[model samples]
Target chain A: MRGQKDIFIVADNIVSPLGGTTAENFSRLVAGITGVRRQDRPEMADQPFYAALFGSMDGEDLLTEDAAASHAAGGGFTVFERLLASSVADALHQAPGIHPADDRTILIVCSTKGNTHLLDIDDHTPAERISLPGSAAVVARHFGFTQTPIVVSNACISGLLGMITGMRLLRSGLFDNAVVTGADVITKFILSGFGSFQALSPGHCRPFDRDRDGINLGEGAGTMVLSTRREYRHGLRLRGGAVSNDANHISGPSRTGRELGDAIEVALREAGCGAAGVGFISAHGTATAYNDEMEAKAITLAGLNAAPVNSLKGYYGHTLGAAGLIESIVTLASMREGIVVPSAGFETNGVSAPLNICRSLLRGPLDTCLKTASGFGGCNAAVVLSK
Target chain B: MEYITGSCVIDGEGGYKNEKKIFSFAAGSSQPAGYLPALYQHFNWQYPKFFKMDNLSRLGFAAAELLLEGWETGAYQPQEVAVVLSNANSSLDTDYRYTQTTKDIPSPSVFVYTLPNIVTGEICIRHRFKGENAFFLSTGFDPALLTRYVGYLLEAGIARACITGWVEWLGEGFKAALFLIERKETAGAVPFTAGNMDRIFKISMPCE
Candidate 1:
């Protein structure tokens, strides 16, 4: 049997309304600044909706100076592709030794909907361009990647699933490095769909709070480069990750959250870490009544209810596919800096279970952090990261 | 290593199970939209949720039903079974339908199925397989990728049995080739290799 290979976080970048690089985003988060606000775009919705949207220059403006110059001359990449490429490029810039075109490296794209907005423009668009694989291929070629990019489209869990897939492949010796990116842009299509479901919070979302209403959607991209070689700063390791389904409902979360709890337990076991060893948890905390309740129940079931828990949704809203990666990036940064970022919108206990929800930033020595995500299609994922 | 114990294939023409012709469509029968319902009736499966499923979910749900017909008798625990599926087009069929609804009041039912993994969820909901699940989008049927990923899951002991394959639906064209994978090799089961999977998929849908 092959020995288990250690996976390390080499570099990461978060391109969202908060900031461009991971450090910038982390600073803004520590300052208690929220990117979500009221937007009255008639094309997106008849009534104003709260979302964290990029100002005027979606993702193109967030590109590095070198990338911006090239993009100024007709980059031709869509908003979604630009978000992904820019993020991957920024992370790659951090580690110059990790070549995008290396045979030992692989790319994984995670998104709930990529280029689906093109469909709203007109009916004449080619099917290939509107497909997820097409978008992935485009991103892969942008960086001259030698291997075929793997695309994960599993609703909201796509990002974390992408990371897990990369870890598995690397452990299997298929590749030595994995550039995993998760991105999704908000559009009229998505807004209307969530509107139809009545899952959108009219104001800023209050995750795990008594006044919690619904989710506030956001648009952004996050990229994390994972490698077998421990040649990066922070020395954050991808300890263990697991995924599961509720098998109860397609759109609704499990009433019991036992499935999610099982996944969390399995992840902790795989990480060879105990519940008491966990320093903090980054809950999904989408702010929906059912989702927050289910997550709280899952956390309590896993016996980690006493750990300090925070949700980045109050800071970034729910970036859909990008939620897992962006939130994970922030969680790792917090773990590295020994700072427990507060759960922005959390104040009073909203669910039936008791939780140590953080309401203020704290500075303490932290070693390990757990990030959890739940999405449509009853999918749930959890990953353990340690310094 | 894992072995392919059972398999099911569904195309526009008909459906097949373990190399046996379980059912075939009538000559010039319902090309795409109606074949799923007909297959559902042919199997005599009674799940009202079938009607609510989009084409992708309907295709996957029916294929899974056939693939796990006799195998669902507790060979593996509910949490020990996993579903890993992929497709070229990620729910484009449902996307188109939901896009149409977006012009007016987008139907929540239609909007819910816009993601590809919803089919995996439907299968899990129907069979109570609460294990790990994932949905990938590939340019085409990449047997090598599926084989490697499932092998990793089985080797890692993440799942004892996994339902993995390609189920795609776009416009009037749909294909569902599902396989039931397990660690123990049974009589007549084939090794779950990429080459073997490619051959089986080729023979299951000769026209492709």
Candidate 2:
């Protein structure tokens, strides 16, 4: 909704290989570090693939270690579920008034293939328990949320779409607060599936780079507490957001990128901000040739070519459900710091259309930022964040 | 304010328009996959892409086809109509089939249909609806939630009309309820309310 009531992102947390919290991840990003590394998973393939994975380290995983301590009362959570709970738990900790039991609070879990990895032939967990909605319910119940949570699974744009869904819920005055979180763990199923499409990169992904190959899949959780009640004095507000379909292909992106441009234009208009007001543009640069090219075309068509654009895929390696929020959180951090984070792995301009790819950190007065994400199934979403 | 202008349904036996069965399968067969192509032939609708689609996409596309059988094409802008769909199982049938291929080499064709909303994309591609679209996964149909979100889209100027559906493509038993909703008033437009939806979904099918 183009809402009159102000919806603010009061608290956010990112649980990723970069770190366990937003600050930790942002600081690591500022240091030009990446979570992408080569791992040997025979179950996935005979070869080692490059990805951002947080495995059970040294037989005592951090997620398990913490979950056992925090959730001593009840514990049947998978690793991804633990990641989701920890992310939202941290966000709730920051904003205390918006408790899970609050009548005005709603939970929205945005995940693609939440527990699908658990459906291996040998795994004994009931089929329903591994369902996306059921997994969301288990997490919501574990956290004691009173209302039935909603689950969104529209491919890679799931996170951004869920954020917009939460904004609509708040704008409709049906819920004063919404805890939006999304997480998807990498499995052999996804790795092989992307392998079938030849969309997986074996090396570090270079977004908007001439040498870029494809995506390096990752797994993590990102959560943001959206509310009309201001929990922080200097918080980022959800100005406008929109979702659209390419109507061209089921799996392939639009060749012209016109549909994505339409989404960005509408989001900016609803936010009451012109293209010139966007200090920086956060792009959905998957590092694939077509994805980057289409995104650059969309940005230029939106008349936002001059804005410094960057993709966090270089650092986070495309963390599926967590990519949009983690990148948005880092973009907000960069905006708050007045320095645009460098496009971590850019070497040269790659796309047919020219974009001002940020090769290094730049300092300026940044205000409103535009974030865009495109996914399989021709789903595209854009959200504007204003300070 | 929105109105439900059209509805369609398909079950184990055959297809129906507004709860009236237009056709029935030959005796002693529950194979929807085998029956759907024959049904498509019966209607003489030609779209080569329908054969390439999975059972889910086929079900959704055929339902939309029947719903729009006699609809006025100029009723609403294609880019201003949203497609909101929900289902309990999130592409598990296809996911299981894809897993079978993953043992050797994953079939890109099968892997692509592993996402539930690919059906929505197929429908949008057929009709050119570029508006807001979302695929929600819930325990069951939540008419109230659908009413609230669809209402939000209308009030926010994000969409002028919507095609809301609840399609489940589990092998043995499948259900699809496709509704075309428009905000414009017309002679026979019914108020797009939760009560109306609950009433419509509760229609008794003579043959289960």
Top model number, lDDT = 1
TM-scores, each model vs. reference:
0.97, 0.96
lDDT by residue for model 1 (B87-168), tens = 9989888888898988877999999999999999999999999999989899889899999999999998999999999999
Model 2 spans > 4 angstroms off: A1-3, A57-66, A69-74, A121-125, A230-233, B205-208
- Per-residue alpha-carbon lDDT of model 1 for A1-387, expressed as tens digits? 236888999989999999999999999998889999899878677888899998853454666665565467775677788888889889989978888789999999999998877877787787888888888887888788999999999999888999999989988899999999999999888989998999999898999999999999998999999999756644789888999999999999999999999999998988888999999999999999999999999999999999999888988989999899999999888987889888888878989997999989989988988899998999999999988
- List the candidate 1 regions with Cα displacement exceeding 4 Å: A1-3, A57-59, A65-75, A230-234, B204-208
Error of 2 at A15 (Å): 0.4
Per-residue CA lDDT of candidate 2, range A1-387, in tens?
333878888889988887888888888888889888898978767789998888642112536344566456666777667878878878788887788988799999988777767755344666577778887887888778999999998888889989999989988899999999998788888888888898988799889999899999887889998999854536888888999999999888989988899999999998999999999988989999999999999999999999899998888888776777877888778777887878877988989988999988889878899999998888899999989
